[model samples]
Target: MSLDSISLEAIRKELLDKFKDEKITNIIQTKKYKIIMEVKPNNFLVLNGINKKRDTFYIHISIDPSSMEIYFSESKNTEETISSPFLNLLQNHLIGGKILDIKQPDFDRILHFIIQPYLKFGQTQNQILIIEFMGKHGNMILLKENTMIEGSIKLVDSNINRYREILPGKFYISPPSQNKLNPLNVNRKDFFNIFYSLKDKSLNLWKLIQNNFIGISLQNAKEMVLQANLSLEKDVSNASQADLEMLWTSFNRIINNIKNHIFQPTIFLDPLSEKIKAYSLINSIQFPPCHKRNFKDANSCLESLFTELEKEREILSIQNKLDQILSKNMLKINNKINDYQKKLEEVKNCEKYKINGELIKANLASIKRGDTEIKVINYYSPRQEDITIPLNHKLTALENARLYFKKYKKTKDSWEIILEQLNNNQLKLAQLAEFHKLYKQYSNSLPNLLKIYNDLMKLGLSKKIIVPLKKQEKKKNKLLPAKYISQDGWEIYVGKNNHQNDFLTFKLASGNDIWLHPKNIQGAHVIIKNRGNKQSPPLETLIQAANLAAYFSKAKKENKVLVDYTLKKYVKKPKNAKPGMAIYSQEKSLLIKINLPEIKNMISQNSQGKILSP
Candidate 1:
């Protein structure tokens, strides 16, 4: 869920409490969506401004989006960011400045950080970093003297938006106001006047409240109705005096929390999927009973939630790309098959041409010059049926027969070549179909996805997936696997990509080591270190390794997953096989449900022999 206005207010207060008056030692735009600043006393503050469909609202201070950072994180994927002039200017103007104050304008999901520039013996110059978290309209703009635009991360012109144009040298303007009443500023008389003024019968109680209130969202408005012991579907005219009293009390209670800065940052998780579902500044009592975890502040909650969400989104994005390629290739194959079938139908009458040629030669004397046709008996026909042979009047009879014979030969030869080409294309289509099935079945497995992408690149099937030589070299240099230390101190390694799977299985693992993978499912290749003990891992260790295999597979969200485990000695990599493809024997299957939190806790206890991070 996006951060609502109440949450943004809570976050702005939290930032002021933590970072007020801190010197900005450095400023770097790690990416267009992210900005990193190093502060005095060793603090890294991140301003993530990604404004995409799935990721609509995130304006918080965190480390980076990829890592699980308790404090802050500097991004390691800086090479992906293109250097821009706007970023350079931000770095030059903001570095060595001190944050004087932070403000969230009227709980509008906007933040302005007032910075005092460092100058030698001069009056303080105030600059502002305005962060607007208004869904697709979200942007970060830097302003000088709070009026003139310095630069913006994104520039909007009259072509993009006529209401507001965010460009350099255009006097900065705040977004147009909705003219809704601020819940905190509304008096009891004015609050009641809202419902009294409403004459639209279609406006329900929930809409009435949300439309009148400045910061209340639809969900929050629903919560307000529940708190007031009233139905959200209740019409505004149906509210009794007692109901109005309850509604007024409830509205004040909720708004008072935001006004007084008493935010209890809460995140709701889906128990079945073990993924975060929603977050809010206040507890959501109207929601169904689920796992609710509260954080000390809003930023910490936002960071933790967005980081995990970003991981899932990244996997989904790659899956979508591969799906598109598969769909296009499937269409191409179907069209080719259709065209070839039509060609085959057209060539089915090649023998008729030969018959015409032979009959014309035998009955040449019957044909005269300037004749368009010749009536003759087809000797080649089983019944000696009379046929009208078409004649090329311009050519001699013998030449006309020769022309038919040449046409017959050419059509017969093309049929043979077309049949051969069709067979080859059919074979290719089958291979692609199999890969498409695997891709759909194991969309969440990064290793499987990378292997499929690599195969598509080699086959020239993917038009968008470009594998640069430098990236290939970099991947070769770093073959990091998902490493976890078991309670028995045995190191367990799980492959995250195709090459890592091959390296872990063939080179790093010993013959006696245990290999685990999801049964008949695309997943990571997991290896449990035996250390020449030549014996099976303990049951607990084996289960942990098996769980990793299932957790990293496409079946991660399933209630129960079956994982197959066997000795590495029984596993064999076929010659010229695709990456991460192997056959094995002497395997045992284990059916179990994976508990993500339990596994995460177990892995977090160990600090050594972990290769998941660079």
Candidate 2:
């Protein structure tokens, strides 16, 4: 469910207090409808904090319908956020600003963030950012202090909502008001009078209170009913005067909590599905049995809630998009390859056409002028025998022979070109397909998935979702090939993706080191170090490295796989080839098979996401 005004009120307070001395350092539009603003302390000396605490945190604003929220996150998700004109406008005006004040006008689902621009030489400007949490009709608008619209995340013209048009230069207007009474501001007699006027005898407190009051959601209403020591099924008309007064007292108690700024933010998760179901600042008796986690504040609660959910969402989203890109492009390449091969086969018959032309020319004069067929002795034939030759009666034998020669020339000229095209397309298809398989193997891994995303882009595919190549590599967490220790004390490494495979083969392994790969199959390039200690690696080490190759390959599931092994010097990367691609000669093939559980044990020695020492 979306957040209600009550939760927004608590969030507004938390953010306002936290931003007392923080200033905006950077702002990024993290998605099509989301914006993240980085906030840092004015004093930067104590900038480092252990664990979840940080000197700098980000405020995430997502106008997305599913998880629309504005909250603080301890870390920024470097996953590619979109760049839009609206995002650019926001950065220009607000990157160097500080939060002057945060207000929730009328306790509605709308928030107004008043920003004070960085102080220049005796000059200052102020801007107000208004964001609404209304589902589907949600909007984020930036306005001048005088309420002129500067820009908006979503533009609502007259056709969509005639009452308000959120266009640039227009007056900024609040959404139409909900005519409900503010329970906090109203006296007890006034609140009771409104409840007494309800005509429906069967109206329950949870639904009816939510319908008639501002800043109260059905979740909040349910809690109010329970806090009153009233049944959720209690009807308005059935309540006596004493019951009404008791309920009013209960309602006043909750209002006092809000006035006193007491909020207990907690998220409830379903024990079975393990997914977050509901979050509450006020406890509810109506909720089913749930596993609950409490937070010190609303921002931390929201961060954990939305971050976990968004990570799952983003992984699935990019995985599906990458699948589509790879599938469509690979199919196109495959079709081109098939056409080239088919044409190559047709062109192989060019020699037959030339032979027929030679036979026709050898007996050109023996053919009658109007004859449709003729028997001729072909000198070039191994058995100098007479052969029947087809004649085009409308043309001379010389003309027919010339036509055959022309056909032979065209096909012969294209054979080599077609074969070369076929080889190139075949190589591209192999690379894309190999990465697609790698994506499935590590779908939950963000760094590897992003690296795969960048690799696919290099292969000449375009799409909106992209992660820059350099972001995947960090100073303290450099990407490396999978490593394993051989039982004989040899160090073996296996490449996980094309870039790492190229690095492992060309940069890390030396000339005398042993190399292994799945023969004729797309898989990891495996290298065994410790070459200086021995002329050849032990049989046990070779077997383990071969199994590692097969495990990280397409043929992993098969009971047995053919693996090629040679000296690292013999395995050469082709000129201008794809990253993982290589050519090798003087290699021996081994039919390798190993226990799956055993190979995984050898790989567990090197955790992929382990932090590197500085």
| Model 2 misplaced stretches (Cα beyond 4 Å) | 21-58, 62-67, 73-100, 114-128, 141-160, 165-173, 179-294, 304-317, 341-348, 375-388, 463-480, 483-493, 504-547, 553-593, 597-614
Supply every candidate's count of residue pairs whose N, Cα or C atoms clash at under 3 angstroms: 2, 0
Per-model TM against the reference: 0.67, 0.68
Per residue, candidate 2 scores C-alpha lDDT tens digits across 1-614 of 68788788888999999986578989888677888889887754543563343478889988789978778877655656679888888888888888889998888888999998777656656889899888898989999899999999999889988999999999988888788988768788788887778788788877888888887987788788787888888888787788778778878888788877787778888887667788887655556645888888878888788777776676777788788898889889989998998898889888877988888787777766677888877677789888777778888888888878888898888997998899999888887877887778667655666667766777678756474423434331234676677888788888877877898899999988888999889889988985564789889889988988888888999999999999998989889998889999889988987579888676565443121221
Tens-place lDDT digits, model 1, residues 299-328:
777667766676566567777878788888
Candidate 2 local lDDT, residue 149: 98
Model 2 has an lDDT value of: 0.80
Candidate 1 colliding pairs: 63-72, 63-73
